[model samples]
Every structure is written in structure tokens, then in C-alpha cells.
Target: MSSTILPVSELTPSAAASEAEDSGGKHPFLVALGQRVRDIRARRGMSRKALALATDVSERHLANLEYGVGNASVLVLLQVAVALKCSLAELLGDPTTQSPEWLMIREMLENRDEATLRRAREAIGELLGSGSAKASARSRRGSRVALIGLRGAGKTTLGSMLAEDLGFPFVELSREIEKFAGCTISEIQGLYGQNAYRRYERRAIEEAIQIYPEAIIATPGGLVSDPASFNLLLGHCTTVWLRALPEDHMARVAAQGDMRPMAGNKEAMDDLKTILAGRAAFYSKAEFQLDTSRQPLQPTFLALREMVRNALQMDQTEHAE
Candidate 1:
């Protein structure tokens, strides 16, 4: 007996062509589908061979599928979804699209007036409760505080100070990421690509949380760009956003004797400002916010120290009750 291979023409030719056209030649549905499969598999720490074996598909075919050129059958896709432990809809849907729950919420609010929608949103928030309540409960039992900010925002300096004050370990997430990649962050990005770097970043955060459940962690500035990893960070650690003015950020970076920010670009300040603006919304999701611009180092440190101490004490009191 011989096995039969399906051709691309047999796999819904019209639909594929329509998708390719809709994407304006940037990425067809199949390519996006393959990328989604690869990302999910990476997050689960599964190899292509493992997925192939689980799906009962040949390694070569699985490779083609991941590469976004395979003309996979519906049955094959279903098997792949099952093997990846995800729904078929997830495998086939847009990778960048919002989750189904958010989409349904949007649809439900589409026809409502602004006032009604606002009330509904408030009710939903009240019913679901704040993420901070859950975080406070966890903080009483675990001492994980994650500091988030841009490069020159003093995350490393302040994180070390806080860790020492609290008698907790301090971990720089970038260093962990480098350790996982077996090279520097720049080298990892150059070698494997940005997506691969993010995968390593996510894995590094997971490992860090597992290893140092009671520690202060300094995270990369752009970690929030990846929603899934950022959500994991928020869920596991009590996050603090250390903020500063754009000028202070630039001055601090320069004070460190690292001129890389202005090494090749005359518009480095403009770029930095743009990056800050883009990430401000995500940074605001942190449990606490502290501004570190233009203040004396001693004063800022003391304030942060006192704030953290109070927060921890409050959590402990709540737990006692």
C-alpha cells in the first residue's frame, strides 16, 4: 500500500486566493496560520517532531505546514490542533485578533449608547473584581515584585536596592534571557529573529518565577509588547512601573557612559519619546506607579522603600484577617 499526498489545488483554492488578495501579498492566511502554530508550539515547549508524532503526520509535512506553504487537509489541521492542545478556531483564526471573549463583549455593546456601555463596563468590573485584589492575596504568600520601565528608568538600580532592603534575591530578566539563549540579547535577536527572542523572553520569565518566587525582578522595557508574556508577568508578580521624564531618561542613560542611544541616530530623543508614548498605556497596568525623575537618589529610594514596606505590611494584615 502507498500513501497519497494532497495538492494545493485540492485545498480550497478560491478561499486561499481570496485570503492572499485580502492581505495585499504581505501574508496569506496559510502563512499566518503556520506562524500561529509555531508560536503555540513554542510556548508549550514542544518540538516540531513531537507535534508531528502526536498528530500522526510526517515530519516533512509538519515542517511544510509550519513554513506556511503546506496544503494541509481539514483532517490534518484538526489533528494538528488536537496535538497542540488548542481549538481548531484558534489555529485558523487571525493570530493578531483579540480573543473570542473580548470580541463577544464588543458585539454585545455595539448597539448600546455610550452611557449604557459605561454602566455595563463598570458593572462588569465590579463583578469580576480588580486584578489587584488577587495580586494582593498572592503577595501575602509570595514576595515577587517585578519592576518595569524603559532602559534608563533605573529599574536595575532600584530593583537591587529594593531586593537588598527586603532581603530578597534580585534577577535581571534580560540576563536570564541571555542565559537561556546562550548568548547576548542582540546576538540572539540577530541570530534567531525577534519572534524567537520573544519566545526566549517568555521562557526566561517563566523560569525566573519558578526559581525565585520571592524576589525582585527587573524586566526588559518592551516585555509588555507581547500580551501573553506580559499577562503572565502581571499574574505572577506584583508589578511596579518606574517612570521618568524623557529628558531624565536620556540623561540617565548618558550618565551610565553608554552612548548607544545616540550612537547612530541624530533623532534618538524623538525615537525614545515615540517608544514611550506607545508603551505608556501598557505600563499603566502595573499595580503601583512611581516617578523617579529629577528627585534626589536618597529621597527616591527612601520613598520607594517605604511604599513597598507599607504594601507588604498591608497584605500581611489582610491575610491575618
Candidate 2:
């Protein structure tokens, strides 16, 4: 099987053809579905050829599906999801209403407005003992502060300073993942594949949440790609999205001298922007957002510190006060 390649002229999804299928002038749903397919595949570090062979899907079919012009049947999608180790509903960008309880819950909440749905979620969380009044109290103390963003968003440097000011431990979840897997991230993916690496990631995050009562934690950018881990982070932590312009993100990562996988790729910047855009929707789920590209390190850190302190209901002084 050859690599799945979309011709240069057809780099983006085929809007006209998709619309014709609408038999719809455009198929944003299928476009998004295709994007999810590509995103999950990339996260797993599996080449198109690998996925094609693994699923016994023809390379041409996979490429067309990815380019958003091919309307694959349910069976084809099932095979792709199985090979990618993700749920079929996830691949199709639909909420999983498989279980009876889930279907019942969906029925109860269906067609509700956003505000109503939010209240319903809060009610459910409280009932489950997960997001009750105690959770609010925990948030006031800043029990868990998780910073999420792409690689060059200053999670490491800013997380360290925030932890120091708050007098709490700082945990880098990526390093913890490596510890749990007993290998580097690349090696974990290479040796056991993305699914195993995701297991390690889930374990590492769960451990961090369990062992640390109050701390600042920096997370992997791709953590958002794994639904389970992202949900755990969201349910347990006060998440902040540190955003930067595409150029700034690239430059910052380069300045750190750790371009490991992206060093020589001519299209690295374009690829970076596409990944950032794809994950931006997920990243925006954070409780707060800070634009790190707006200022220098000190100023940006100061702003972040203030924003976090405000969220924690802390006074303007350091924890020592």
C-alpha cells in the first residue's frame, strides 16, 4: 500500500463534490468527520499505508475518505475506527448514545438550550459526587491547575512559576507518562503503538490527579486528542489554554532547542497551523484562556498569575502572605 496522498490542487476537502452529495452544496459534517479521521491517525503516529493495511482498506479509498470526497459506508468507518483504536461514534463525530442509560439521558436532555444543558450537566455531576459543592470548594483552593496548549505555548516555564507563587508542586504530565511507560514518548508509540501510549497517558494523568491535592500541571498538547484523558482533566482540574500565534508557537519551540520531530520538515509550519486549528476547538473547552503571544515572558507570566489567582479567589499577594 502506498501513502495516502491528496493531490496539491486538492489539498483541502472537495467542497463542490461534497455539496453535490448533499446531494448538499457542501458537507461540513463529512469534512469534519474526515478531519477527525486524520487527526486520530496522526496522533497514533500511523502512516496512511499502515492504517490502510491494518484495516484492509484500499489506499485510494482511504485517501478519498480523508479528503472528504468519499462517503464511506458504516462498515468502512467501523473498520477504520477499529484500526485506529477509537470508537465509531467518535470517528463519525457523534455523541455515543449506545448504552441504555446514555440513550435515556440523551432523551432527557435532547433539544435543550445551551444554558439548560449546562445546568443539567452540573446537576448530573453533583449527583455523581464528582462536581458537587466540594468541587467548587476545591476549585477555590486551586487544588488542580492544568495548563493546556500546543508545544510552544510556555506550559513548562509558566507552570513552574505559577506553582512557585502558589507554593504548590508542579507536575509535567508528559514526563510522568514516560515514567509510567518506562520509555520515551516516541519509543512508546514505536514499540507498542498509539493505543498503548494513550493508556500510559491516561494512567499518568489519573495518578497525578490522585497523588497531588493541590498543584500546577502541564499537559501534552495532543492530550485533547484522547477523549478519556481530556475529560478527566476537564472534570478534575482548572484548565487554562495558553494560546499563541502560529509563528510564535513555531519560534518558541525552536528557541527551546527541542524540535526533535519537526526540525527539518519544510511544511512543518503549515502542518503546525493545521494541527493547532484542529485542536483549537478542543482546547477552547478550558475554563480560561490566555494569549501568551501578546507579551514577553515576564509580562505574560504576570498576566497568567493574576488570572489564575482571580480564579482561585486569592488575593493579589503570593501564597506566603
Candidate 3:
């Protein structure tokens, strides 16, 4: 059971040219598909050879896939997706973009700038009754402030302080998750695995949202790993990214006596950086972010307090010195 990709048989230049000609002007769909495959592979931290082994698909076919010349059969595509641990839809994109009007609209929006795309997303959300128009956005956002970021970013401490100041209940979601599973996080993951742990995590969040309207919630660092749960938090709470420097993160985690990451693992810093980079885009989706490393805890708390109060439209003069 070796997880090794067999050697790939190279295609001749004439054969490549024939593939090009047969694809009818480079096959726009498959070209985008190949690019998508490459991007997903990178994000998943899998080398092309690794992916080939995981899928049990030939390296030559995967090479064709990356080259945008592979007319992959349904079975082959399914195997690759299963190996990649993502749905075929996610890897290939929504299959519903088939109609002429749908294709044209999609094409038009595909090249628009981020700002334009964001505005379009907002509009679509509103029209679909899932956006800000459906609720008093400020009230909803102000009531629930969810802290997100790396584990050592002071989410627990800050969440408690902010909650007490706002007279809202403070919920450390990780604790609730453990309660739901009837074991510690390490035990949950070790015994049942990550998938089971994520299920517990999702349920914990759902229950938190349903039961507590006015609360300051400190979420697990990896909550963003599950898009459904992350989207739920985004829709229901005012999310904040509690940022810290890489050195600060390590120091803080070590100070807390959690040496799991750094214990005998010399590449811990590099791994931490990679995790940060991979999840940075998702963290940036937070409505607000504060860098805790720039100032002392008290000042950082004060700044966070100010930001949250303003976001929730609470009394600013109460804590004024």
C-alpha cells in the first residue's frame, strides 16, 4: 500500500498538438477546470504526484488534467475528487451554469473587480432574503460578537472582557463542543477523528446561536475550516479576527504551557506560518480585526472594547477615563 505515483509517460509534441486541435479552441470549460484542479491541489498542500497516488489515477491522466487537455471520464474525475477530500462540484464548480443567459452573466461577472463582485454578492444576498435587508443588521451584528483567529490570539480573555463590558454572556465555544461530545477536544479527535469533532463543533455553534442572542463567543481557531459553520457565524454574529504576530503566537501558546506544537518539533514555526497563510483569507472575512501584538493586553482590550461598542452602538462614555 505504497502511496507513490508511478512514473508518467510523456506525450510527444505532435500528440499534444493533436489534443489541442481536438479540444476545439482549447476547451474553455476544461481549461478553467484544470486551473481549478491545480489551485485546489495547492491549497490542500498536495503535490501532483501525491494526488495521483491518492486517486489511484495514472500520473499521465493527471498530467493531461493539469495541461487542460484531459477529457477525464466520470469515474476518473470522481476518484480524484474523493482523494482530494472535496466534492466534485467544488473542484469543478457548479454544474448549473449551462444555459446561455447564465453563462453570459457568469462570464460578465467573472472578470469584474473584487469591489464590484462584493457589491453584487450583497445585492444577491438581499434579493434572496439572506442578506442585511432582512434584519436590523446593526442590532443583530451588535448583539453577537464572535472572536476568531489563531489559538494564541487571546480570544478567550478578550471575549470575556468584552462580554462583561457589554453585559452579554461570554461563551467559549470550545468548552461547549467538549460538553456536547462528553470528552476533551484531544480525546474527541483522537478517538473519533476530525470529522466527528467537526460535527460536534457545528452543533455547538448552532446551539449557541439559537440559544444566545446577546453574547460574546470565542470560537475555535479552525472554525473557518468548515464553510457551512463559518457562514452561519458570519450571518448571525459580528465576527472579529484577533490577530497576533507569529512570534507572539508561539510565545503566548508556550506561556500557557501548551507545548504540543513546539514540543520536539523544530519545524513548528514554519507549520504555524503555513497554517496562518492558508487560513488568512478566511480570517480576513471578519468584519473587524485587531492586532493584539502591537500593544499591551489592557490597551488592546480597550481598543477592542471601543471597536465592539461602536460596532454594537453601545455607550462609549461609560468606560471613558
For all candidates in order, the CA lDDT equals 0.77, 0.79, 0.78
- Rank list by TM-score: 3, 1, 2
Of 1 and 3, the candidate ranking higher by lDDT? 3
lDDT of 3: 0.78
For 135-184, candidate 1 gives per-residue lDDT tens digits of 34364326788989898888999999999989999999999999988999
lDDT leader: 2
Question: Which pairs of residues collide in candidate 2?
Answer: 19-24, 19-25, 19-26
Order of candidates by lDDT, top first? 2, 3, 1
How does each model score on TM-score?
0.65, 0.64, 0.65
Which consecutive 10 residues in model 3 have the weakest lDDT in total?
1-10
Question: How far does residue 10 in candidate 2 sit from its true spot (Å)?
Answer: 43
TM-score for predicted model 1 compared with the true structure: 0.65
Q: Which ten residues in a row have the lowest lDDT in candidate 2?
A: 4-13
Across 135-194, the per-residue lDDT of candidate 2 in tens digits comes to 442543346889999998999999999999999999998899998888899999999999
- The per-prediction CA RMSD against the true structure, in angstroms, equals 13.0, 14.7, 12.7
List model 3 lDDT by residue over 215-252, tens digit each. 99999999999977886787778889999998888988
